[model samples]
Target chain A: MSDLPENLKYAKTHEWAKLESDNVVRVGITEFAQAELGDLVFIELPKVGRVVKADEQCAVVESVKTASDLFSPVSGEIVSVNEELSDAPEQVNDDAYDAWLFCVKADNPAELDTLLDASAYGQLIAE
Target chain B: MASYSTVSLPTVTTIHKTALYELHIELGAKMVPFADYQMPLQYSKGIIHEHLHCRNQASLFDISHMGQCSLKGSSAAIGLEKLTPAIISRLGSGRQQYTVLTNSDGGIIDDIVVTRLGQELTIVVNAACKEKDFKHLRKQLSNDCQLQELSEHALLALQGPSSSHVLQQVAPEACRLQFMQACRTEIDDIPCMISRSGYTGEDGFEISLPNRFAEKMARILLNFPEVEPAGLGARDTLRLEAGLSLYGHELDEKTTPIEAGLSWLIKNTHQSYPGAGTLLNQMQNGTEIQRVGLLVEAKMPVRENAPVFDNEDKLVGRVTSGSFSPSLGRPIALALIDTEAAVIGATLFTRVRNNLIKLTVCDLPFVPHRYHRS
Candidate 1:
């Protein structure tokens, strides 16, 4: 079973969003997503302050075998991104929840209601 | 599931199913379609871990889909030697050699592993090109000889530093065989053919057994603490690190063994063999492009089909195979380039998407070979 925390919301694409005070929701891929990708070698994330729509591709993670896109769960303006991942993307595989991709100031916080909670996400992936 | 903005997702094709499909799924492996089989590309342990396991310990691989056969007759040696450049007649009993099935014009048809087993010769060819290879061999050899395809057999490769030790527990005599030698042995009262050869450049064995006994043999081997089941993804990367060539990438119909840097397999004494004239001529006047190894300076890997450029940014060739070599902890590749451009330490550039990654021509077998020759 994947280590999905109860504090965050998840997208069906396997990304997690954690609310970080006020309207900011920090985003990152789930552990299951990184494990499926194997060893990550390169990552291309969107620039800071870039406005991204919900379900839009916000980043790209490439492993030795294949490349995958990271989608945003809610419409938001990017505030901060993990610059350390530029050199060591394997950290995402090590701790997906901790290796947050970017912090976005969500345009609509109510969009979180549509996302699955930790228990619901667990039930969804269990199938 | 919450609805999201729609985007064109990459088409996920139907994965081709393999004979051991259920077994892989049970092991929690990541299955992918490769060549026509729904093979296990990696297990839950991942490719790098599986690759390192095969180097340090033993790893079992399902290679049953590869073609295997036996050629028998009084004129089998002479008849087969006419098609390949290897000196098969001179190979001693229980000896194995790597040979190329060649075209009349000296191009490579396929690379095969040929083993001499007294009155008959056992051969293993690539899975994808077996049909074409069998048809060509049938046409080239005389009717006095017989060719029997053993498609019903399951082939498994047990490779690593500890392979011999693990195999000795079952077949004690197998521990005595030297590299490139083969013998018929009984493992736990089951009949099988064991060859002291493998693609990973480790001390290992390729065991051929009846289909009915394959699952059992696999279970028996996996019982050993040192052995684990690896998938095709690790197999490919391990072979690449060992400087071994794959059929579609390095060995192909348009390339010759000489051009591929496998000229040593062409014996000097085989003067009357097929393509000997063309090979000897190429030997006298070296080939235009020679296969060479590359060491990428950056962490980003240069995958297959990436264009290679010279110092002046002139396109010289393309990468045939490339990967992040687990053993070396860096990116390595094999490329066939113009002879003048293949010099060691020559600065080259590999076009990786929009960025031009710098590379250097380095020696192959990025990891030192650990085969047990004694």
Candidate 2:
């Protein structure tokens, strides 16, 4: 079984989101995504105030093998980002869920209900 | 004498395998199709581990899939000179030169390693370009020149700081050879040609032997505690960090050796080859774009074909090859930029996906070459 934190929510694209408040949340990629990408050589994140649509490619994660897009799980305006990744992107490989890529002020907090729970995300990755 | 089988990617049914294919499978290598052959990309430890290990100690690589050919006879030297403008005629026996095969337009067809051994000239060409390279050699050379493709032989590279010490254990003569020099010798009774040259920046040897002894030789070398078998994944990163150009990525049919910053490869030959006219023109007027190494500022690696922009946001060039350097602990890249923007320390920007990233022109070989000079 893969590590899927039961307290958080996941997207099919492999991003994990944790609700910080009723209208705000923090987002990062899951361990599975980082492992699949291999040694994180580069990470491109959205700017703090950018509005991203759900499922839009708002960032990129590059590995030695290839580059993968980071899709937003919900519509939101970015509030903060992990600046540490600018120098050490491999932190995502160290602990993906803890190294939150960005924080967002959600436009619709209700959309969180549509995301996969830890159990559903676990089953999805298994496939 | 050909044994290479380049398989079509659509199906996995008929991929060619090297002599060490079974050994790689037993070691848990993840095999993938490369230049028509099923080669290992990585093993159980993955690419990063293999890459870092090669730098720290010594790593053994199976490069037998590369094409090997021999040109002999009294006219061999002149015949090969007609194909490339390198100093082959004056190239003394036992000397090896890194040269290029050019078309009539001065564009690079393929980058090759030519070594003068006894009366025959041994050539190592890229795996993907081997078939065409051999065909071109046969067609272009005069009848006096005999071209024999040595496809039945296997090539192995043992690279790193400890390579000399480990290899010297089996054959003491190997340690006496200098960088870019080759010598024919027997390693544990396996007849081989060992060259103290490699794609990796580290000091190493590339040994070629007949097919029957290849697997036996690899097993003997791997028996050493300091030598670990590395896959193609580590091979790519090591070469990129060393600033060596891949034939297809950093060279192509439309690009010249001049643009690739390989002017040194062209010797002053009075005789004209295929691209001599165009090469002379470029030498006089300078090239439109030049290849330069980049030190990517952030963690983002600028992958192949990513457009590069100057500080003014004008598109100046594109990255030919880019990757994070395990040795330098920073992202390093090779880009083909306008000649004006290729100055060292010049700043540039490139897009990795949708985000803009910063890069600066710097010296090649993110890691200094530690070749054994003596």
Candidate 3:
């Protein structure tokens, strides 16, 4: 029931990626991921311009009862981070699709095909 | 496949299962062993969702592992009065009050809920100490009254601000009842005892039904748009936010009701009860440590058993229960601190892991109670 756009790619860990201009990919958690971790109270975002590999922990979202790690979907150099989430992390829970966590310049654009497409990611979560 | 050498493993203790075990599994709950019961710690919707859901709407909780029993016959009230400090004889029908079971030396055995149901008195004890409570009750009470354990029944709690509305949709009669009142009713054709009482400090009800009909009743209740199945993890956080006491942490054999600040439950008119004299002595001379509420001034929570210190760095007491109160948007705790440091505005410190978190003694029930007293 999450808003999984067909044009986007997703990681098995639940992060979503949308390719932007200039080889930059905008990354954020899926709606399903935010719903699974309700009422987010705190978020620890990675510094901007930091290099991160695929599956690396890029952020932390602490809910009322538990804390969860936000993983990076592709190897990239962080170009810009969502500084707004530092003050109001619940914006992610309110609208996960629109609240981008960060933007990264991928080392290789071909890495996008290595991630699961919208339909495949939906099928994976259905299981 | 080659035969493998057998390794010895620790024997698993017999854990009590709830009536909604199948439903919990179907919802993908994370089961954990707690107090000899296989209880759900959290569900697939997760603890934060469940906790917030209970505060905003109604959440169904399976608390059937708690012990339920009835004391019957003519002399039941007088017999029970002899064991505990609560004035049971003064209680009328449909009245519920908190009381404690005390040992011979005036120490607490366990805290329990006592309800007067017509001629018989119904009691709910902690699950871990039910056996000990039963054995003590047997020895103290006269043979005129019979003690009957209702272990075959399952207890369900539907709690939140909207619980009354959700329950009223199915059973209209429940809407007329005030808080702490109990009545026999039918839900989806299953006869049950519904009490307008809960631990969440919200307007809610606790229903006791036959074990076989528990799942059906749960399904019927969950059918309400506002109701969701919550687990034990949220239950603990909610209770702590309400400033309610847990058995092993707040109440135990070494502590008395007076020290736990539960002297309100003990009636001075109850002349012949055990622990009355001891409580009177403590009231006059005062106890060493007193339980008080603390508001932590930090983001990280200070969990149980955290050492409490004064501004001068002297150890005063320890935290019994601590958690990030979902309703209050800050971490809070209940600690038993030195009587001198129990002032409402007294500054204190709780050592969480390696850091000394600043705390201040404050009023209880971090969130305002929403119980429908009327």
Candidate 4:
């Protein structure tokens, strides 16, 4: 909750979704998740044109000691991925929200409404 | 809106804590359950930072979980020779040799380091196999040899280039000892059995002292600017880069020393150890599979149990140990593969999830060993 942006919504799987427009949303892991994963060394992002369902596995983040699957916060089509991460995965460790994993075009705009706000997400992590 | 199954947390289990447990906690270490003991995985500085520091300077490791015991008798070395293929009789006093305990079928029971102190032989064994190793020793050795577990003692490893200098301030005589030598000395008035050897393939010393003085000694060593506390995570990476074989991975009950790339440990003339028949046979002929180093082509780590395949998709071997080397700045591994695939520079493949990653056979010791021989 220390750096959880007030405007963005969060998924229980530790992913954050920021609606850029009516249909497009930027997705990334939370700062809390990155801190738990230690220093990341590699990341495998989903294909740009791949169709994904809400809460489905879409990417992977690997730290020096372990690797974790990143689940999609909402159902959509992946329009773009962060190419910069392939060269410097540590960028995500530097700033989790800033290093967006991918941009998805949401199939249903109402799905964002179901995500947790900053206060709710803060409580979940605190527990 | 969608519910995803959360990663299940490991159940709370009571585990043994070392004498340095409180010190490790105070140092902001991330504790993990390992070998039935609560051991430090890393400190606040992280694994990569600690690993690099060990290579450039020096680091201290709490290895109290490892088992230490002594075989007391004039014939202790000869008695131990019956269990291992190493020529222990020739080992002079105040010297140590890395050897393995073999079963009747030539399979490795456990790898151990045996030190000769006058007429007694002291040994250090793996933490996971300590109890079993001692039981085996008790049953196998003759009545003349008495086995005593040094359970009250705690062990510490101070490794890297500056290790000798750091240790010299407290125990001066330990610095003069050559590699693989041991001596009973006092450090800051605390009695200890100091040895010039370590698992990191670096110039270091393994200090064994009573548990009561462990925290005091650790604090003293930590006061030195050249020494920092390292955890089991960095230890694994350092040993991996050093190309040292880890038990339960590169070695197991079904694997022999010859197949594990430890043929040098088997003395050519001595063939009377537990599994001498099959060991000498493999030594004269060859093993079916050999442990070899691999240079992983992909950025992703190829971890243990990953299947290795040849060009035709035929399964040839499996990865024993794999990780992203902090020093090489790339992924490296060790695989026990068929003799045909053990060729240096030969390309092999390992499946990671949905992709087949390419791997090349490379020479061991991704990093060179820096021992203080002089």
Candidate 5:
């Protein structure tokens, strides 16, 4: 089992969201998700200013084996995108927590409480 | 959420386990359902490492899921010639030839490797098409030929540049055999048949032995420092880089051998064979669409079924097989396209999602094959 960061909240879909400051939340895929997907060759990040709803498909991640859609955990407008992923997508595989995919200005900060905690997210992956 | 890929999923209820199933698990392999069998997609080291390890040193692959069988009779060679385009009778003893099983309509039923061993001929067919291939052979061949499935046998391939150096430790005589040659040998007092050929385009050996001894043999081979276990994931990338045609991807019931750029395998003689008329015609004239390799300029991979287009944005073909080439560190693919657009240096494009990626129609084999030929 992979380590779950206590400070971050996780979606059942495998994306992790961290409340940075104010209403802004940083998001990226969990470490367990990267292992399952294998070496990342390509990543399509959601553009800045793109308004995405919770549980809606916001980005795409592709490996050598297959491509997958990444869903947003919280409904918000995309404030910032990870442009570095365009050149080096393997960084996510190296450090999933450090390589955030996008930052969202959350519409409801209370949605973070609704997400799974560290222990809960660990249990979901264990099953 | 990640969508499940059907590529590695098992559709059937009855699943088969290979002889090295336990060994694979011991090595921390991530197993997936493939062709009704639980196969390792990669080991703990991952696909890229496994692939390069095979290229630089040596890697052991469990090919037990592939069907192994023998055709024995006085007219076995002649009987096999009727199904494939290769001149089976001309294949000398202790030698192997790559050929395809064709239907009457000039379409490929399965791609197989046939080894002539004295009076009997042994064939290795793809796992998914083995049952159907045996049925086809039983119905089409004459009564003189006898088909026997080697179900109790396990097939293992040791592939890489250092394969011979590693195998020479066990079977000395097996290393003396050149490429495409085969011989019955003994390793650790166990009877085994080894062929110096493989799908990875390396100097390797495919060892066939009884199922009871498979675990012991794999353990002995794995004990070597150069040999590490590779899985189906690395196997796919290696074969694609070698520019080999896969059964379902580059070939199928609807695709002919000639269109797949395998005209050299067909004998020049006008011998009677399945789909001989169309095959001979396509050989003499030309095929409308020819299979070629594509080098993707963009970083993203162009997957199978992606529509290919010409410079004018005209629909030309579809990508049959595409993957990230670990050797080249870029995306490579095989696409069947119009003969006019399928030149050595012609530019083509493929649509991936909303992006139209530029691709160049280059020669087959994004990476060179290092086969040890005498």
Candidate 6:
């Protein structure tokens, strides 16, 4: 099983989010998801300052095999994007969590309740 | 059988496993349904490592799913030439050549490698097209010739710079063979008809033996530290970097040899094959669409069937195959474009999502081939 830190929250789509501040959240795909995606070649992130709804397709991640739409985990405005991924997209495969796609400022803080804890997400992929 | 391409092929409930299926599981391979067969997409070493390993050292690939068969008879060589555009009758025994089977309308039936070994000819076709390819050959051939499919055989390719060095540890005769040569040989007393050819554009040999000894041969080859197991993922990237076309991606029934950039295949001075009427006509007057290579400066990879356009946004062609070239550290693709725009160094556009990226028309063999010739 891939490492899933207990403090982080995960979406059923294999994205994990960590709350960096009171309302600010860091979002990226889970380690298990990156391994399944093989070597990531390119990434298209949502623009900074763009407002995105939870579960909305806001970005795209392309591997040699296929391209996948990256879904936003929370309804929020994007504050930052990983610009280096345009040339070094393999960072996600090297370290998924550290290579967050875009940071989001959550609209309603309690929306984190809708996400799964590390244990729950672990069980989801195990099935 | 189906394709390894996830971008293509429909979802299915059942899949056939190869003889080395258990061994792949033991190596911690990620299995996926390819050509309706459960196949290893990547091993524990990952696609990049396996790909580089094959280029620098040696890699063993279980390609048993490809269709292997024989055409036998006094007229096997002469009669077989009538169905395809290759000069099979003149191909000579002990040699193989890359050729295509064409339909009556001048479209390709399948791209295959035919090896003429004395009285018989051995053919290896794509697994996805084997069923229909066999049915078509049987229906078109005369009674004097016999078409036999090797249902109980397994194929493996040991490839790279050190392939012959590692293979010499088992079969010394492999070292004497040149590229595109085939001979009846043995490893550990198990009979195998090994060919000095491969799809990865490497100096390699494809070994075919009975199904019962499949794992035995794989184990023998893997005993060498230089020979590691590579999977279909690495196979795809390697072939793509080599600029070799995959069956379903770079070709299909609707595409012709001339349009697919395979005019060299029809240059044997004999066009007396099926589809000769239209194939010859197209050969005389150039094909409207020409298959060419593309180098993308952008980070995003242009995918198959993506609409290609001129700088003015006028539709000109479509991408046939695309990928991030591990060997070159950039994105490259094979596209079919209007003959007018197929000139080398011409600029083209491919739409990815909502973005139109610039592409330069380039010559093929993204990486140079290293085949060992006589």
Interface RMSD for candidates 1 onward, in order: 1.4, 1.4, 3.2, 1.1, 0.8, 1.0
| Per-residue lDDT of candidate 4, residues B167-207 (tens digit) | 88999899999999999999889999999999998999999
CAPRI category for model 3: acceptable
Worst 10 residues of 1 chain B by lDDT: B11-20
Instruction: Evaluate all candidate structures by whole-model CA lDDT and list the values in order.
Output: 0.87, 0.88, 0.85, 0.91, 0.91, 0.88
Scoring each candidate complex against the real one, what DockQ results? 0.50, 0.50, 0.26, 0.64, 0.76, 0.78
lDDT of 3 by residue, B214-302 (tens): 99999998888899999988998888888888989888888888888887876767757776788878877889888899999877667
Candidate 1: tens digits of C-alpha lDDT, residues B1-374: 23583876666544445456677788888887675567788888888899999999999998876889999998888888888888888888889999999886788899999999888898899988888989988888899989999877888999999999998899989889999999998998889999999999888999998888887888899899999999988998899999998999987888888999898887777877667888888888999888999999987778888999998988899899998888887788999888889999889998775667999998878888888786
Pairs that clash in candidate 2: B6-B36, B7-B36
| Tens-digit per-residue lDDT, B1-374, candidate 5 | 23675476655377899999999999999999988889999998889899999989999999999999999999899999989999898899999999999988889999999998788899999999989999999998899899999999999999999999998899989998989999998899989999999999778999999999999999999999999999999999999999999999999999989999899987779458888989998999999988999999999998988999999999999999999998998999999888989989888998887888999999877778887787
TM-score of chain A of each: 0.95, 0.95, 0.94, 0.96, 0.97, 0.96
Task: For model 4, give the interface RMSD.
Answer: 1.1
Per-residue accuracy of model 1 over A1-127 as CA lDDT, tens digit each: 6667989999999999988788999999888788778988777778898998999987888787766888888898998999999888889988998999888899998898899999998888888
CA lDDT of A32 in candidate 3?
84
What DockQ results for candidate 6? 0.78
Model 4 alpha-carbon drift over 4 Å, by segment:
B1-14
Better model by DockQ: candidate 2 vs candidate 6: 6
Clashing pairs in 3: none
- Residue range with the least summed lDDT across 10 consecutive positions in model 2 chain B: B1-10
Query: After TM-score superposition, what is the CA distance of residue B265 in candidate 5 from its true location, in Å?
Result: 0.9
The CA lDDT at B86 in model 5 is 90
Worst 10 residues of 6 chain A by lDDT: A1-10
Count of residue pairs whose backbone atoms collide, per candidate: 1, 2, 0, 0, 0, 1
* Model 3 DockQ vs. reference: 0.26
